[model samples]
Target: MITVVLPTRDSAARLVHVLPLLVPAAVDGLVKAVVFADAGSTDATLAIAEDSGARVVQAAGDAGARLSAGCAAARSAWILALGEDLVLPDAWRTPVEAHLAGGGGKPAFIAAPGPLGLAGRPLAVLASGEAVTAAGGFKAGGDPLKALLGRLRPRAVRLRI
Candidate 1:
């Protein structure tokens, strides 16, 4: 089982687009839970998250801090962190299950063709055990590369398209 963490600040519009895409994963049991680390959003983001059965964590800092808090609040051994605007492909479950079964320590990211077509890319990212530990140890806006390389050896897994 895996938990999905989404860090957001006034991202209701984006959530509307992304949350629905996540529901199927949750229903399929691939996602055990969804946590939204909110950074003082006065908009409908909180309401939307609540309505979707997502646990809300009060986060007050930069993106990295919010992400860390969310990951810390996760209950599953595997955690998937995602941007509010990203949407995973229909075939995402296969590679995620494969990674989990493979017992690889490297973090995996969905392959994107380019910057212009980010939405067309896969949305799932399987955060390894090392990556989760690194996230908790870093501060707000901390460099991700440092986390990936500092505590443990770095080897990134990319989900093929």
Candidate 2:
């Protein structure tokens, strides 16, 4: 099972769009849990998260720190760290499952679909590691390419809508 971790601070509007996309994964048992490491929100972000069955943790710090905290709280062996504005593609389950089952220790980046049939930008990265060290070295301000290169095996997987 995998846990989807995201950091939110007054992200109610964004979650409205994102939560729906994640529900299917949860219902299908691919996503065991959703962790929202919130820094602080005056809005209904927490309310929405609870309503969606996500475990909300009190997180304090920058985006990277919040992400790390959320990841640390995850119960799954694999973790998918996603941006607030991103959404998983309809066909995400197959590829994700394949990657996990393939025993690829290297991290995989989910690509966002671009205009028309063009390539999209990398959105999220999935990895397997220790409770507090999953997706190693790819911190908020770290160099993604360098981190990927440092790994024993690196593979980039794109998720197109």
lDDT of 2 by residue, 1-161 (tens): 88988878998987887778778878888899999989898899999987888999888866666777788888898788776454556667777777778745556767766788775655566776452263364355453322442452435444343
Query: In candidate 2, which residue pairs clash?
Result: none
Best by lDDT: 1
TM-score of each: 0.79, 0.78
Q: What TM-score should be assigned to candidate 1? A: 0.79
Model 2 misplaced stretches (Cα beyond 4 Å): 114-120, 131-161
Error of 2 at 56 (Å): 1.0
Global lDDT scores for all candidate models:
0.71, 0.70
lDDT of 1 by residue, 1-161 (tens): 88888878998877877777677878989889989989999999899988999999998887568877888899987777764444556567778778877856567766546667552343445775457686443356554323433443345567665
RMSD to the true structure for each prediction, in A, is 3.8, 3.4
Pairs of residues at least 3 apart in sequence or in different chains that clash in candidate 1: none
